[model samples]
Structures are given as structure tokens and as C-alpha cells.
Target: MEVAEQRSKVVEAYIQAFEDRNAEAVMALYADEATVEDPYGTEPIKGRDAIYAFYQKAMDLNARLSLDGPVRVAGDIAAFPFTVRVTVDGKRQQLEVIDTFRFDRQGKIIEMRAFWGPLNSQEI
Candidate 1:
């Protein structure tokens, strides 16, 4: 597949998998040695297994995530802006985040980095 097509597919997979809370589906889009640095963390999560564990924990926490629009891809990389809703301590909140994904030659995502914005900021 062309790099652009691959990028779109991978980005879609991520959005769909997370919205469905299906960790396995998300992992399928990753390379064997993929790494993820999601928000709320300093160290990156390595490998599909680790990513699966991370998603599982998020699913268990009842996270509700949604994308704002189509992901923008450049070369083998893409950036997806998203809004995630979660309930914590009996309060509902929304988190604004931007996720950047880098794909390997095989079109499998090799690295994903996520940045989060301030909580309940008027800008959001």
C-alpha cells in the first residue's frame, strides 16, 4: 500500500479501536517493537504487549475517547487531535490531547506520542 493510504488506515484503526475499547485491534496496527508515550506518563510504553496492557487499564477505567476530525499525515507520520472523556472520583471530565504516530516501512506504527492539554481550560 502507498504510504499515504497506510497512514490513513493506521490512524483510522487507532480511532476505531480506542472508541471500541478493543486493545487487540489497536495493537494490530503496531509493529512488533512499537512504542507508545501516552499522556499521564513520562516513560514510553514499549511493544504491543505493553500497549495492550495500557489500553486494558484505560478501558477498565471506562475511558471514552473521540477524535475531532480526520488525521493529518505527512510522509510516514500523522497527528490526530482528540478529546477524551472520563469519569473520576464521581466527576466527569474531558481531556484534550494530540497524538502523533510514526509508521515504519511496513506501514505498521512504530511510535506514538501523545500530549495532553490543561484540564477544563477555557480554550477547550
Candidate 2:
């Protein structure tokens, strides 16, 4: 399969796992030494264990994720624009984000960076 196509599949699996709230499944798509820098500026979570913990916490919040647009793939990279809906303290909120992933030769995500900010979130 083409690299772009493989990367697209990886991104698809990622979205599916995240929406399913299966942190283990999500972590399976990442490389052993993968790094995730969610929301862009915060400290990056490195390695599978840390990444797993990060996803665990996020999934525990019961957030629902949906694709906002098509997944863009170039070479070994994929960029997914998505929306996350969550209820925090009984207040429903929606966050628009673009997450970019760099995949390894084996199709595992090596790096993930989520782009979003306070302005990207709104009450829903």
C-alpha cells in the first residue's frame, strides 16, 4: 500500500479508538517511543506509558470525538481536524482541534501534536 494510504488508515484507527474511549487501542497505534504534545504548548508526553496515561485521563472524561473534515495525509504524516464534545461539571463544551501525526515505517505514530487553544473551545 502507498505510504499516504497507510498513514490515513493509522489516522482512522486513531479516531476510532479515541471515540471508543479505548486508551489501549489508541496506544497500540503509536510507536513505543512515541511522543504526544496535546494542545500544542504544554509539555510533551513521551514513551508509550506516558502516552497511555494521557489518553487514559482524556478518555475518562467521556469526551466524544468526531472528524470535522477530511484527514489530510502527506508522506508519513497525517493531519486530522476534529471536534471533541465533552460535559465538564454539567456544562457541555465543544473543542475544535487539528492533530498532526508523524508515522514510522511500520505505520505507528511517532509523534502527535494537537493544535487548539482556549479560543478554540466553546460551550455547546
Candidate 3:
């Protein structure tokens, strides 16, 4: 398969795993040394363990995800915008964000970044 096609599948699986709240399945999509910079400006979580922890915390929120638009793939990279709705401590929130992934030659994500800020969130 072409690099873009392969990367698209990877992205699809990542999204599905995330929505399913299956941390192991989500971690399977990343390389050992993968880094995730969720929300862009914060320090990136480095390596599989750290990334696993990050996803674990997200899953604990019981957020439901939906695509804001289509996934776009170019070469070994993919980017997609999505929304997450969750209720935490009886407070509902909706997050609108775009996430980008850079895949390694083996098709595992080496880098993932989420683009969102305070203004990107809304109380629901």
C-alpha cells in the first residue's frame, strides 16, 4: 500500500482505539520513543510509558469523540480535527481540537500533537 494509505489506516485505528477507551490499543499505534504534546504548549510526554499514562488519564474522563472533519494524510503524516464531549465532576465540557501525527517508517506514530487552547473549550 502507499505510504499515505497506510498512514490513513493507522490514523483510523488510533481514533477508534481512543474512542473505545482502550489504552493498549491506542498505545499499539505508537513507536517506543513516541512523544505526545497534547494541547501544543505543554511539555510533551515522551516514550511509550509516558504516552500510555497520558491516554490513561484521558480515558478516565470517559470522553466521547467525534470527527469535526475528515482525516488528511500526506506522506507519513496525518491530521484530523475532532471534538470530545465529557462530563467531569458534574460539569460538562466540549473540546474542539485538531491532532496531527507523524508516522515512522514502520507506520507507528513517532510524534503526536494536539492543537487546542482555553478558548477552544466550551462548557456544555
Candidate 4:
């Protein structure tokens, strides 16, 4: 299979893993040295261990993700828009987000960045 096809498939698997609320499955899609920067800027979580912890918390939030649009693949990166339904502080909130995943040669995600902020969120 073409590398681009493999990369695109990885993106689909990522969405499925999150929908399953299976952190381990999600981690499988990442490289050991992966880094994640949720919401573009803050502090990036570096390495697999840290990345795992970050995702675990997100999983614990009982977050449900729905694709808002198609996944766009360019080179080794995949970007897509999605909506997240999660409960925080006893309130249900929805976030409209776009995330980009940069994959390694083997198609494992080596970097991930999520984009969203107050303007993209709403109390549901």
C-alpha cells in the first residue's frame, strides 16, 4: 500500500480508538517519542509516557468525538475537524476542534496538535 494511504488509515484508526475510549489502542497509533500539544499552545506533552497520561485524562472525561468534516492528508500529515462532547465541572460542553497528526515514516503519529479555544466551545 502507498504510504499516504497507510497514513490516512491511521487517522481513521485514531478516531475509532477514541470512540472506543481505549487509550492503549490510541497509543498504538503513536510513536514512542510522540509529542502532543492540545489547543496549539500551552505545554507540549513529550514522550510516550507523558502522552499516555494526557490521553488517559481525556478518556476519563468520557469524551465522545464526532468527525465534523473529511480528513485531509498532505505528505505525512493528516488534519481533520471534529466535535467533542464531554462533561466537565458537572456541565456538558461541546468543542469544535481541528487536529493535525504528523506521522513518522512508519505511519505512527510522531506529533499531534489540537486547535480550539473559548470561541470554539459551547455549553451543551
Candidate 5:
């Protein structure tokens, strides 16, 4: 697979998969030993199963993801700015986030990093 050509497609799929609350579809883009570190500072969940579980929990909450800007691709990594809106206890919250996905030669995401923090989120 061509990394440059496929990276944006995979990123778009990821956004759709998450918005669809389809953890399995999200996992399908990951490598067997992929890692995910949402928000970047905490411990990264490693391996496919762990990553799936992580996404499962969030998707279960009915999180909706939408791109805020164009996806940027550089070498093996693709980055995008987005907003995740979810309702908690009948209150809607939105978080502004940026995520970087590093792809393997086969075009599967090998590592995913999300950049966000408390300041990036607020009740909506």
C-alpha cells in the first residue's frame, strides 16, 4: 500500500468508524501490535485487543467525531484536528483534539497519539 495515498483515507475512515460507534471497524485499521495514547501524556494502551477495548468504551458513550481542518500528512504520519462531542448525564460536552496516526508500510496504523487536555474540553 502507498502510505501517502492511503493515510488520509485511513484517517477519514477512523473518524467515520468512531462516529458510527463501530469499534470493530476502527480496530480493522490498526496493526496487531498497535498502540494508542489518547491525550498523549498517559500510558499508551498497547496491542490490538487493548486498543479495541479503549475505543469500545469511548464509542459506547456515543461520541461523535468531526474534522475541524484538513488532514496533514508528513512522511509516515498523518495528523488532523477534530472535535469530539458526547453527552454525559444529559449534558453535552465537546472536546477539541488533534490526533496523529503513524502508519506501517502496509498502511495499517501502528501508533496513534491524541493531543488534548482539560483545557481543550468544555460543556456545550
Candidate 6:
């Protein structure tokens, strides 16, 4: 699927922010009232402050993501699949993750949701 030209830029910003571990940069990609559903088991986290906390927790994992393929935009939303390689509790793990992003008319992400599962069946 083809990502909207404008939204593609915003997605790039998100990936760059993640790679940099710059919370502020990550927040910039979202609107003030943006909602995120990372680790989807929990309720959707709303607003920039909550989103900041989510990213902060992720940063604590010392995580880094390698995205696959271009962003797939469908209407006002887009999705990109990624694999995160991180070391938590002295063990390295690969996580297969899918990130879905929603954008407002102005192109700022109004909502960003992420879900993931362990690449290996071994329980952590």
C-alpha cells in the first residue's frame, strides 16, 4: 500500500525519533491530544503527556527498531511493520511489531497504536 505523500514524512519523523531516543522529537510527531495504544493489551493512552510516558518506558528498554517496507497509508491512517531488537534483563529478544498511525487533516498524527509479540515462543 502507498502512503500519502505528506503522511509519509510524519512517519519518517516517528522512526527517526525512535532511533534517536528523543522523547520530545517523538511527541512532536503527534498532536496535543494524540492517542497511542502501544502494547494493546492496555487501554489506549491519550494525549501527548501519556504518549510521552509510553515512549519513556520504551526508552528504558534501550530498544531500537528496524522498520520494514514503506508506510502503508489507507485513507487517514497508515501502518508499518517493524522488528525491535532489544536487551531486557540481560537477554536479547526480537519482537515483531506493527504500528498503526492516524493523522489529522494537518498531517500531525492524532493517534498512533502499536502491538507486538515475541518472535520466539519462549516465555520471557
lDDT of each: 0.82, 0.89, 0.89, 0.90, 0.91, 0.80
Give the per-residue lDDT of model 1 (tens digit) for 1-124: 7677778878887778888888889888889998898763779998777888998998888887788887889977898888878887777777788888998987888988988846532222
For residues 1-124, what per-residue lDDT tens digits would candidate 3 score against the true structure?
A: 9787888788788779988899999998999988999978889989888788888988998888888887899877899999989998899999999999998988899999999998999999
Q: Which pairs clash in the backbone of model 3?
A: none
Q: What CA root-mean-square deviation does each model show from the true structure?
A: 2.6, 1.0, 1.1, 1.1, 1.3, 2.9
Error of 1 at 9 (Å): 2.1
Single out the weakest 10-residue window by summed lDDT for candidate 1: 115-124
For model 4, what is the C-alpha lDDT against the true structure? 0.90
Off by over 4 Å in 5: none
Model 5 residue 110 distance off true place after TM-score fit, in angstroms: 0.6
> TM-scores for all candidates?
0.87, 0.95, 0.94, 0.94, 0.95, 0.87
**Which of the two, 2 or 3, has more TM-score?**
2
Q: Give a tens-digit lDDT track for model 5, residues 35-106.
A: 899879989999987888889999889889999999999999999999999999999999999999998888
Runs in model 4 lying further than 4 Å from the true structure: none
What lDDT does model 3 reach? 0.89
For candidate 4, the 10 contiguous residues with the lowest summed lDDT are 2-11
lDDT of 2 by residue, 1-124 (tens): 9778878888888889988889999988989989999978999989988888888988999888999888899877899899999999999999999999998887888999999998999998
Clashing pairs in 4: none
What lDDT tens digits, residue by residue, belong to model 6 across residues 1-124?
Answer: 3348777777788888989999899988788888887776769888777789889888878888888888888899988988777887788877778888888876788877787755432323
Best of the candidates, lDDT? 5
Model 6 clash pairs are none
Q: What is the lDDT of residue 17 in candidate 2?
A: 94
Report the alpha-carbon TM-score of model 3 versus the true structure: 0.94
